[model samples]
Target: MRQLTLDLQPAAPPSLENYVSGSNGEALTALAAWLAPDNREPLFFLWGESGAGKSHLLQACAATCSDARLDPQLASLPTSSGLWAVDHLEALADGGQVVLFNLINRLRASDGRLLLAARLPPRLLELREDLRTRLGSGLVYRLRSLSDEEKRAALAELARARGLELSPAVIDYLFARVPRDMRSLTQLLRAIDQFSLEHKRPISLPLLREVLQTSPPT
Candidate 1:
């Protein structure tokens, strides 16, 4: 079976409103409250597997408040702004770990804020014990992947909103054949919409297979 390309098209901009929390609703709620201008929380760490919406939530906060975003590889983190976001912490270098440790200390001293997302939880992170403890010191939230039923409901809503019709069989075909992440599924749906329009064919399993054929092999 041919694989469909999901990353070619950029996803919709990440935003708090667009994120589907599923079982992680409580995490989302706390994040929203933390992003409030008046809130004084020092830091938050979101950890989960890839495609679990960790990046989305952090970016949503940064975009919503114009906060500085820190790179995982940066050794010299910014000291100008109290608000900062660091993504993909698993790739951070040792120098970065030291800088971040000090940065966290300062954030606590000044009541500044930091946002972090990683593939692992703080206790399990391969970093300095102090840094790991500092990361876990804040309100840590683990993002949960959406279940098939939740994804199906979201897809149905997306199809309805776009005035596109997707049969249950096509959706089942997608779940079985393609990546299960919401972002990828959404991209697939868009690709199918465009392909159906171009070929003047009804959306169907055969058409989906045809569309999948157009993407280069993985």
Candidate 2:
């Protein structure tokens, strides 16, 4: 019997290079310039639906700049003047909200950078009115989900980067049988590549089927 565990392979940390800019080029461009000395924007907030790359962007921003990834539940925040990123804005507790509220207020005076992401826009979040107002005061951008064509383009690029040759038939099978989200698709792509290498087989629909049969359901 053959068994597979997706948990054995940890996900790669989000980075700027891996992020696919489908309709998000403007927002991504701004974030890529986060550490530039000439950037005058002190705060940046991006909102999108689940799996729309909001959290991914925030994480990538933090990793790129080596900034402090603040905890949304922390009672206190650092006073240093540097970049700070936090995900899931709605999960913030009272203390964290107060701290973040004050942090945004002090960003301009201290020349700091703030990056935030949430499923809802700042005005829609159920937060303090003052905090919501502050959130909107900065540069706000809506992250758009990738269309099917853009995803296909990204998959080709991803496969090329990984040195994997995936035919259109294999990609079609992936779309039909697997979760269509990029994250899930990326992981499954890696899994199939590993399976093919382990079995010394070319990547094909038959191989993907074989792996999918032994592998757990998505």
Candidate 3:
């Protein structure tokens, strides 16, 4: 059989709406509800396990808001503010959370919006007093991990977007034969893309399995 080929150049990151649509169903719906206009200016906390798409949702919201071309001042900080996306709120240390709380408070008083993401829920965050209080009062959303079915669907979608013509049989084979998490799946896909370019071979079950066996531990 003739080998299928895919152009391997990178594309811009997928939008949050599209990324959520491709995520596990529950997360997509819950995020939509939390992001609606009726909820605007209400604090939104997105908590999830790693690889659960919180970053994607945050970036998407930022991108969508940026695209609206609202006054640059409004979208920016200090002189202006519209939307604020604080990624990895869990990484904040010392009095950082309290500072964040003040920022959010000011934005909200001015009728602006704030979106925050973290690996754990806000109440559990080891943060400063005012920050903890603010987080507790916010509308929290969880981005759940993908099921096996959702994982397969997501991988297939990624392959298509990358222009790789893969069969369900092949996708299923890799899903079972290798590490099945989204991160590993993406790593495997990129490796295959590189391998195809180097050896000029199409992505196949044999090629993927070989790559898996020989690849160093991440």
Highest lDDT model number = 1
Query: lDDT by residue for model 2 over 1-218, one digit each (tens)?
Result: 46555556567788777788898898888777765778979878888987778877777765222222365555445567478876788888777788888888888898888888887899999889999999998888899889887888788789988898778888888788877788877787788778878999999887877767764565
Better of 1 and 2 by lDDT: 1
What's model 3's TM-score?
0.67
Summarize candidate 3's per-residue lDDT along 116-135 as a digit string, tens digits.
Answer: 77888877877776787888
Candidates 2 and 3 compared: the better one by lDDT is 2
Alpha-carbon lDDT, every model: 0.80, 0.78, 0.66
Measured on C-alpha atoms, candidate 1 has an lDDT of 0.80
lDDT of 3 at 188: 70
Candidate 1 minimal-lDDT segment of 10 residues: 63-72
Cα-based TM-score, every candidate: 0.83, 0.85, 0.67
Q: Considering every candidate listed, which one attains the maximal TM-score? A: 2
Model 1 TM-score relative to the real fold: 0.83
